[model samples]
Target: MNSHTAFVAAMIAAGMFVLLLGTFYFGNFRRQKPALWRYVADIDRAGAMIRRKEYDEAEALLAPLASKSDAPLHIYQLRAAIAQHKGDWVVAARHWKAARRYFPDDALGFAGGARVLLRAGRRAEAVRMLEGARSRVHNPSQLTKVLAEAAQSAGDWAEGARLWEQVRNEAAGDIDSYVRGHDCLLAAGRPDEAAAVLADGAMRFPRDPQIVRAVAAAAPPGAPGPA
Candidate 1:
């Protein structure tokens, strides 16, 4: 064929392919859009019900959604929340574990499970659970912070100090990290490390009264005062 005729045919074929793609995309989107909205709306309603202390209704509302083959991760979270509020630690743990099992790459399940365990005063278990899932969760600093707190609560001061330092390394701007890390270090009988943490926090947050006080307290009896 001549170049002109060949070019025209190619252009028409490209146009048809583009039209086909657009038609399929928009048609699929239109079909799924309403279901997406309803799914979100139901999740919101269930969340509100849980917030209002309507555990039974929240559970009922979430049950059908959870039964669906492609149920969202939120369903398990909501169910766990309801179980937690009702003081059913066993059920809460189960749902949170299910969330982790179903959504391995998400941090919410592991973090939420650790939170529930912390609330139930199972500090060591909470730490262990989060530690095991450390490699799976994305952006695991938040879980690291939780583990730090859990270690502190369990009186595992050495572990707490290590985890808190990890948190501080991940997020230098987190004031709690410096304060908690320093405290845990002190509790673990590491005076030098504690002093170092306090000094760093004092330098970064010079005006923060907590860190300022910590620095003053850590100073030697004959040392020069803050100027």
Candidate 2:
């Protein structure tokens, strides 16, 4: 071939190579960016992986998307939970704390953070954090049980009873919670209060065996029946 024709063909070949390379590496000429959709799909799979207790795989899938500005709030939640599954309470608490800012009205962050601390044997800090979280929480009913346990951890039987009372009120048929409340009151050396709770239970659920049994069990030897 002539030198001029050969030079022209070489230029065309180089241009074609650049076009294919851009399309392959950068997803050129596609709708939005392919990576964005892939990120979303990765997150969904990661959540399922987390549920399956594949923490390492879930974390690997989430790591790249976690740094995205528009990353889902559950990314941090899952990270914290993954850490929790691995028994790394410190890392779990840190991620849960970060997630808390995104979920100002939800108790997941506060509850998870406090629970990890409690499990890690930091009762004082856990209770303190849980106390602060109480006001910020929007759905008290949803967290009644969580708060009750935290109160028990803090050795605040009165608070535990109060939260269990909240639970009982929210779920009127929740005899289990009322029983727990009585137990907490008894633990605080208030047998009278314990009997009172059972008595109230019997009044509310006249036919429930739970209330009948609890009332019988809560009484002290030779003590008058609950008022």
Per-model TM values vs. the true structure: 0.61, 0.55
The lDDT for every candidate, in the order shown, is 0.83, 0.76
lDDT of 2 by residue, 122-210 (tens): 87786677667768887545456777887876789988988888888877778877788998998888888777877778888877777
lDDT of 1 by residue, 94-151 (tens): 9988888767777778888888878877877887888888888776787888888888
TM-score of 2: 0.55
- Model 1 clash pairs? none
Q: In candidate 2, how many clashes are counted?
A: 0
- How far residue 58's Cα lies from its native spot in candidate 2, in Å, is 0.9
Task: Give the runs in model 1 whose Cα sits over 4 Å from its true position.
Answer: 1-38, 114-128, 171-176, 189-227
State residue 170's C-alpha deviation in candidate 1, in Å. 3.1
Off by over 4 Å in 2: 1-44, 142-144, 153-158, 170-179, 182-227
